[model samples]
Target: MNRKEANQPSPISRRLFFSYAGTSALTATLVLSGCKDDESGMPVDMGVDLGSGDIGVLNYAYALEQLEAAFYTQVIQTKYSGITAEEEQILTDLRDHEVAHRDFFKAALGSAAIANLEVDFSKVDFTNRTSVLSTAKTFEDLGVSAYNGAGQLLTDPNLLLIAGKIVSVEARHAAAIRSLINPKSADFSGDDVVDTNGLDGQMLPDKVLMLASPFVKTKINASNLPTP
Candidate 1:
């Protein structure tokens, strides 16, 4: 399942890159801090439940997109201190990209997409720079791994290509954020996350959901993943 056409994106800049990274880090901090505290939530509505099999996998990706979209939205709304012009711009771009991904999945899933996911990140400290950047690094890294691991399981080349393109960007985000934190901690793409054949590792959907469970309130059923 894939879409046929889309708008084109404008060129990006070096300064813009840095700006996006800082702003994104700032946003992750906010979510990690407040999402956990906000008890207000809407009733689960719209789309299809992630049935077992391939449908479950799509729902898994959608769930992740929801979390990411929420995180970026909060970051842009309440930015961290010491943010520069370049950082602001790039963060804006990333926010837009995440929003696009979220909406794309929502549209594609039609009746198969799961309900709105509630996220809680109350344990994080937004004021602290390290915590924000580190958390961002984790999300980016996990996203890359998730896409990589899920690739082979995807039989549709179109879907595979879509996942592949997105994961590369996720890896880029991971690298940029990791540099901010330590200038050298972007190695989350290790053998563990990458299988023995030097291919991107594939984590079962259940395991991926478990890693994401801290933020999402609902449990996922991956019993539907196709048996290879």
Candidate 2:
């Protein structure tokens, strides 16, 4: 294959995709009830209500995965100027992983899944490496924190296990992006994100959504999510 062809992003295998989908289907069957505004008993007219309980948490994750998948897809499609082969390969892998994750959550939520979110990446400059990587770092960090914070809200052990697995992957992605931004440095697990107790930072849903709002055009109503 030519260099250009070799650098092209590869699709995730059907076997792997189906494996995740199957797991998601089982989880959905076990956890979800009908999608409804549990608090108001009426559909949310202002925006998407992320439901309540475990279903709400799953939808929240699905939303973030959608954003990440879309961002990396755009980056790969319109690669930044001066992107090296290594960078291209890294980004391609990230894109594939995020897409898999996004679809996995969608499959898990089934009928309870939130509608496809409309994103606004207008602030991101795809042509600039710094702009892309910086945004990537922000997203990866936020994803890790989001899962960590939401974990306590999940009552089901199976769901908690799944969330744990996904958060570990998100943490890895955050580290990779951090390394890219500050190669061969301790910034990969910087004190900013990792505290004195050596634990990764966690953010509640409200704070996470607020920070993520700029990139998502869909007004998310996360009011019904369980509190700590």
User: Which candidate leads in TM-score?
Assistant: 2
Each candidate structure's count of clashing pairs: 17, 0
What TM-score would you give candidate 1 relative to the actual structure?
0.69
Which stretches of candidate 1 lie above 4 Å from their native place?
1-49, 184-201
- Among all windows of 10 consecutive residues in model 1, the one with the lowest summed lDDT is 26-35
lDDT scores for all predictions?
0.59, 0.82
Using Cα atoms with residue i matched to residue i, what is each candidate's TM-score against the true structure?
0.69, 0.83
Q: Write the per-residue lDDT of candidate 1 for residues 10-34, one digit (tens) a residue.
A: 2332233233223321121101111
Per-residue lDDT value at 51 in model 2: 75
Cα TM-score of candidate 2: 0.83
Model 2, 51-128: lDDT tens per residue?
787878888898999999999989998999999998998888788778878877775666788888999999999999
Best by lDDT: 2
RMSD for each of the candidates: 11.9, 5.2
Q: What is the lDDT of residue 45 in candidate 2?
A: 52
